[model samples]
Target: MEKDRLVRFVGKVMEESGFKVYKDFKTSRYIIDIYGVLPTIVGDMGVVVACKNYDEHWEVGLDVLKEMEMIGKTLKASKIVVITTSYFTNSASNYAGRRNIKLIDKDGLVTIAKKFSKKENEIYETNVIDENEDSETYIPSTKSSKGPSIFHAGKRSLSKSGRSKSVGRNLNLGNFMQGFKGIMSNTVALIIIVLLLSSLITYIIGLFNKNTALIGVSKILSSAILSYGLVFYADRDPNVVLTKGTIVFFVSMIIYVVLIVLL
Candidate 1:
């Protein structure tokens, strides 16, 4: 199966097993392969599962375990599981056993797939986070205030420095949108307002100037001034300005399209 679909299958299995699951689960630290919960003898165990599809034998090693261990502690996950189509090395297995991390080889994955297939009908489908969605996201599977465990996991492909950056970065902005309107904030909101005004000004100038290049320049200048005003008022950093500005431009274009069609 394709990697995306493979992860989704893992998610479905988690659902069937009666665990709340999120596929492509992102966290402040790193992207989780699969995050879910399972009822256990002790308590509800938050699970962080990493899935790998490789042509050759994929060994879960000490490095992978250390990453998981750190992430598990960060999220308070009760268990960490790595599922791969490739076979595990002896050292890898030994390292996992010592840390209480579960390693599932090709055969093990098949077993879980078979076991969960029985409850295939009731699998809880969710809006899985896409890889390119953003650098930071940790959307919960459930909105209930009670569910607290937010498991995080990652890939060996990520550089050690990259993982550290993710772990260190703040995720407040990524998770703070109350609604579409709420997204319109600081320089982002200002850009859209100026863009609309610029559109009107450009249309008016077109009646005389007739130079498309000149009109485009005017639009850019107008947007920059407005954006600068917002940054000045909000004290937003350049990164925030750029990120929010991109969002505003696209969303405003869509809104303009809809308005034009309606008229």
Candidate 2:
């Protein structure tokens, strides 16, 4: 079969399976042969598909699967599928299994084609697949037994919102913990923490003593130190660190003057 024909066939199958199918869907990085979306009560599930029209001697490899996986991720698709006129390599099959990508070989294609013809009340003939070959479709195993619910609108909404809030909190906590761990391991970050603490203490003492000059000096010093520490810690050029430090010092002095005048 030709590549265009294969893509059309796959799009038809997806449409029959209740997907809103789009052919030759274009993304920022790729032009997907087929894209489908299955709308449910909870949310819309997207599927990214690629079609390969290879001869029997040629087989799809792991690289193709990896590319399809990337396209799926870029589109945030719920499923990834690669349908081919030939078979797949062992490595490709294994990788697809691990990545939850669906691989449909020539035999599987024949099976779906037959079904599609039967549905359309038309005769479909193809010499691409062997008649004796066993038809097997590979569907990745999913943990959920009960799929998305269409009923219980109120209850589902409540449960979905609760899960979203829980996930958000857990993600925030995880990010905070990771950032704290990174800061603890970095020497420059430690120095910056110390400088900030010392500056706060000095500012408090200066305020108690009514020493405006001391407060202004402490603020300027801390701001410059903080900026320099950040630039150095980020592994920037020395020249960039110096430039940013000087700019931050002057900016801090200007802010101090404006604040003093306003107060």
Best by TM-score: 2
> Which digits, one per residue and each the tens of the lDDT, describe model 2 over residues 1-263?
98988887787666654568899999998899998876544356677888999999999999898898789768867567888999999999887765547788999888777655643442121112324444453221121111111110111113323533443444344334434533432445544554555468666878688777777667666766665665454324367467755555555556556766999
Scored by Cα lDDT, where does model 2 land? 0.62
Cα lDDT tens digits for candidate 1, 1-263: 56787788877755644468877778897888888866543345567888878655556566776787677767767567887877777888877755547787888776666545422322222223233355455433322111111222222114334433443231122122111222234345565676677688778888899897997777666655555554433323356566655565556556656776999
TM per candidate: 0.43, 0.47
**Scored by Cα lDDT, where does model 1 land?**
0.57
At residue 185, what lDDT does model 1 achieve? 40
TM-score for candidate 1, please give it. 0.43
Model 2 TM: 0.47
Off by over 4 Å in 2: 122-263
Instruction: Note the Cα lDDT for every prediction shown.
Output: 0.57, 0.62
lDDT of 1 at 192: 60
Model 2 pairs whose backbones collide: none
